[model samples]
Target: MATEITTAPHDGSTDPASPARLCGRLLGRVETRLHDFLAAERELRTRVDARAAAPIDALTALIDSGGKRIRPAFCVAGYLAAGGDPASEDIVAAASALEMLHTCALIHDDVIDASPRRRGLPTVHARHSAEHARNGWEGEPRRYGESVAILAGDLALIYADQMMSEASPSLGAAWAELRSELIIGQFMDVVVAAEFSADVALSRWIAVVKSGRYTIHRPLLIGATLAGRPELEGAFEAYGDALGEAFQLRDDLMDAFGDSDATGKPVGLDIEQHKMTLLMGLAMDRDRRTREFVLGAERDPAEVRRLLDETGVRMDVEAHIDRLVEKGRAAIDAAPLDERWQRELGAMAHQVAYRNS
Candidate 1:
């Protein structure tokens, strides 16, 4: 970690405890510390294996790329809500580790999606694939590039584990569980993509494992456990589970229809891949032409959007998001935390449900 993490100057009058302020503060600190840590690692790798360092270079570039920092923000909020020292280095490192884990997941996810762009930039696999072609590599350019991208994601996972090592044993356990579930979700994703008919139960399970627990519940649990307030686990779990699932559904809708500038990636990639999502599942069941269209090889973004709307998939998705957010708000209200934390959590839930970027 850096000797110090500097962020935009703030005063007490701004209510540092507010969700937005707290998120900004923690995200700023996490980025500063994360850069410092990666720089040191890069130096070490450069000295040991200069060629192998390329993966780490890619990893750092992805880190520097933009993200909402939602997972880390949730980590900080969990610590604060559970009455931990919000200013402590341990908390910052833990949150930064969660961000690193997210980086790993996204790198792998982009590869799985065969996505060309992310955060409005070339994806790691796509970038490396292009580089291989430019440099006149001997083997298949795509394979070489994907291989490097896989190594980069592996390094990121290692970095995430290293970041979490300083935290308590309980925190480490949560991190392990998250990674395991992520693997299971990825396996299920591959299977669903290749074989399964659209099944709502299967789709929801994917959301729960891939996005719900890994994205929110476990991160919050890590923070809360590190805060030494395990008693608040039940309420935060309820809140995290609901918010996390809603967060993912909203993302699916955005990737299907949102503008590239707003979502930071080209839209309709999921439709192009024919991945089974709740939105797609609902539409597939309700509309035959939509199912036939999406299941076939050719992708028509216009028709996908029309089906998404005409089949009421968009409205149903929105309704589910609203309901889940309400469930999270109720959990926040019932949690035995400070009133300020309650308000902040309510606001967090709102942001999760409503954010476009």
Candidate 2:
């Protein structure tokens, strides 16, 4: 949900108008805006005096630990590029809703994946699991842990829906479609991991649903919709596809080579969890040895790396990542974006490709 991006702290080497600069500037703006939004939500919670505030305690931690608010910033950027008002409460609401939706997805995703960490801290499940054990107030410890996390994720989704509803019912139908695609994507990821659909076509479908629509297309579509730029919707959709693919490529790269401390999750998690990412698919698709290695793999990272090395799987996957980067840049180039947004988009493409997290 955080649409994880990897970037180093400011080194003062890049110009302010550079893509890195734009990304940093935009991220700063998002952080500031998110704080305001969370404060408002907290104020609302105080008035409601409901159990919903329980999740609010860790909410800021989770949000603040996020890699970057790339999706929400893109939504706002796209909206503005399409001649939309950045000051529109509805537009801001829509961007905020997307962020919430992404958070909900990540909460559920971490639970489903049984991930122990995120953004360099204990994942929600891990936090709750530890708490459950410390309190020693229940049945099976794992069950308690999973149950609390499930409830937390559910709460996030509920709050996200509430936020979306406040964004204007005009976005309801589109939001529903986006939500459905996300579910379908998650399901496909699970099924593929179980060896249900190990084909290349199926992997592509998963890419479209998981990364394409969820992160790229849907967010941009919502932005354009709010901007009322109906004519250029197709262009935005195309841009989203490329950007989303680029985003996923980076995800695959980070999964393999990222800093566990930075990503807030363990490295080699995809291999450990057996999630069917496009990188894994490319590895398998390349040769018979790669297929055997991946399929018969254990949870051992060294073994996985060895297999990847022997079959050139890692190299092949890395090559595909480069290709995706080029494709994303080309798509952005083709898109009808304003100069400012175009520069930002190009810079993001670089970050997506080269990110170490």
> TM-score winner among the candidates?
1
Ten contiguous residues with the weakest lDDT in model 2: 4-13
lDDT of 2 by residue, 1-357 (tens): 445341222344456544344444544555665677667777788786765555665566788776566667666666666777545766666767777777778878888888888777887778877887898866776777677667767766776787678767777877899999999889888888887334876777788778877776777777777788756667666766766766786787678767777766788888777777877777677777666766763446667667777777767766766776677667767777776566566666666556666
After superposition, which runs of candidate 2 have C-alpha atoms over 4 Å from their true positions? Answer: 1-52, 297-300
Error of 1 at 146 (Å): 0.6
lDDT of 1 by residue, 236-316 (tens): 788888987898888888888888887778888877777788678777887888888877878687888888898788998
Top lDDT hit:
1
Residue 297 lDDT (model 2): 38
lDDT of residue 98 for candidate 1: 84
Clashes of each: 0, 3
